[model samples]
Target: MEFMQADREACDRLLPGLRERLLELPLSELESADSPALALFREYGGTQLLIPADRGGLGASALDAVRVVRVLGGLAPSMSVATAMHHFSIGMLYSIADLYGKDTEIEPILERVSGEKLLVASGFAEGRSNQGILSPNTVARPVPGGYVVDGAKKPCSLSRSMGLLTTSVAVPRADGTNEMGLLLLPADTPGISVHPFWSTFPLAGAESNEVRLTDIFVEPTKILRPPPGLTAQLSELEEAGTIWFQMIVTAVYTGMVSRLAALVLERGRGAATDRARLLMAVDSAAMLAEGIARRVMSGDTGNDCAAAALVTRFSVREVLTQALDLAVELLGGMSYIQSTDVAYLTAAVHAIAFHPPSRTSMTDALLDYYAGKPLVMA
Candidate 1:
């Protein structure tokens, strides 16, 4: 945790310089030099924070990932992950080996990840599916030696310069229940293919793509945990995934919003009627963000982190939208320039809506909380 706090400070200091450099590059260019970034990445060990310390990772908390989301969201948005996002994933399954315990097949995988040799992408989204439904179209049908994973996952978050993905497939059980099992797929697998699928914000480091798994045979060892609902154990893991996801994702959007608010304040100077309003928005949102972060850090569980997260998310979207309006209103023609962050702000407003349990979904979730449905991941 101390290291994570230190990493946050380092990223804060490094971001402005990095953003300047990022701006200089063509937005269309997809590849980035891994060396310099990796140096800073190594300093913090990047997404390795999500992994466990025993496995050579920072073992940063769900909130720690949230903190990272804020930092990286501000610096890079969704265009490229500053470092690879680990599929902490089943690897987390390995880290807790004593309790839920280890799978020998995943130990070396986590070792390589902790060593920073391989990249992991998350494949979750599916086409034409209902929001918040875990049922996936990607089928992992049972076969003689292993399951044949044959399906295409749409809008999966991946790295352009890297390979490998961790995903879940819905299996039909003889017991008449659907099962979701996770898998780790290598980039070089014979039948696997990837294609980029841009989101609302072109620059959000999300870098999702369509992943097609064509009759690829995954060994039993590489298969992640058993299907969801198979036991109370799987349900617990799902909740944990929900909790971590909410925290980290909230971190990213709110971070971008925080920066956008700051930019608005810096540029809104002398703009007359709107300056005071913009200042209030930024300062208000900042206070809210800081307060909620403190609560999360103190390990406060009873508090409404979900509602606080929604408010933070809404605050970010509000501030960014206001900032863009203020930027166009204050800077006149210069706001239209391609080099301006105002342009980026314009894109980010749309980008925050990319993931599920989105603003609308989040609002519903928050409402459910108020209705006393118990702040469960639902």
Candidate 2:
């Protein structure tokens, strides 16, 4: 679901005037066969794009974040992914700083993040990690000063310009269960190396990677608070927050859907019947997405964040597929032209339809959640 166009006005006020100009520029990068989208993050001051104002940030909340991004994402399908990635980093850091790592030493970094001085991206994926748990196969062995992190993280968005690397590494804790620790590895650190090139079909604008950490020493201060206890509190915490991030992700895909819907209406405006129903579905899906975001942002503790994520994703999936079908059916032969937006529109649908947190796992989780069983297969 996407936000109403009018809602974007309030969301825009959170950022400086520079955002509009940035959005207006042509940023088709790889996805569009041009300059990479990573450039845009640098233009917007990276992670500082939407920090909350109260904490020396842009003062954006969940819904505001959703509205502003969905609008831009609808406009620039390829380039917007990088923008959204930077925002994700900002959101995660801010949330983490608030919950655990509160020492004043972090304030300066937080300030830099708020000011968008450095770009950051998540580095949690590992060769053997479970996509659902976000566990990393990387290992962090404690060293004299800090720890040596060694392993590869796959498909890290913005790996090139990312100054700060936030990752999860397998750290054996006192408890029998393997504990995952969050580590901050600077991009310039000696042993850290990123593959020179990266690309994804729909997110051509953003640069992702196979990130390698070869026994790199990270200072003790760099580690964010170790994830909360894995047993009880953390399990529940992960369950709650994971869906929220997923919801944020849904906005990117549906944002594009909203744009396609608008175009269909503009093209058909009283001209066709099939296109009208498709447009209605797209518009309705966008509204539903916005509603879910608003509920979460409003402090509704009862929000089924995961459920919303699952339902929203499935809805958007159907919305895009149907929209594409309608485009082809209504436009007839014109839609088949490779040069037309019809192709990109449908390609993007498939792109997000299969984005990480794969549909199968999402459905399984949703089923168990609704069935009220233990969330895992024994």
Off by over 4 Å in 2: 1-4, 7-11, 15-36, 104-106, 126-134, 174-177, 196-201, 225-233, 269-272, 301-303, 328-332, 335-340, 374-378
Tens-digit lDDT track of model 2 for 288-347: 667777776666523365566557767777776776566555655654564445566566
Worst 10 residues of 1 by lDDT: 30-39
Instruction: Report per-prediction Cα RMSD to one decimal.
Output: 5.2, 3.7
Q: lDDT of candidate 1? A: 0.53
Best by TM-score: 2
Residue pairs whose backbone atoms clash in candidate 1 = 69-252, 77-205, 78-204, 78-205, 78-206, 79-203, 79-204, 79-205, 80-205, 97-101
Candidate 1, residues 208-294: lDDT per residue as tens digits? 566778988877667655533356555444444443444454455555555555555566554566766655654454455555656
The TM-score values for the models, in the order shown, are 0.74, 0.83
What is residue 317's positional error in candidate 1, in angstroms?
A: 2.6
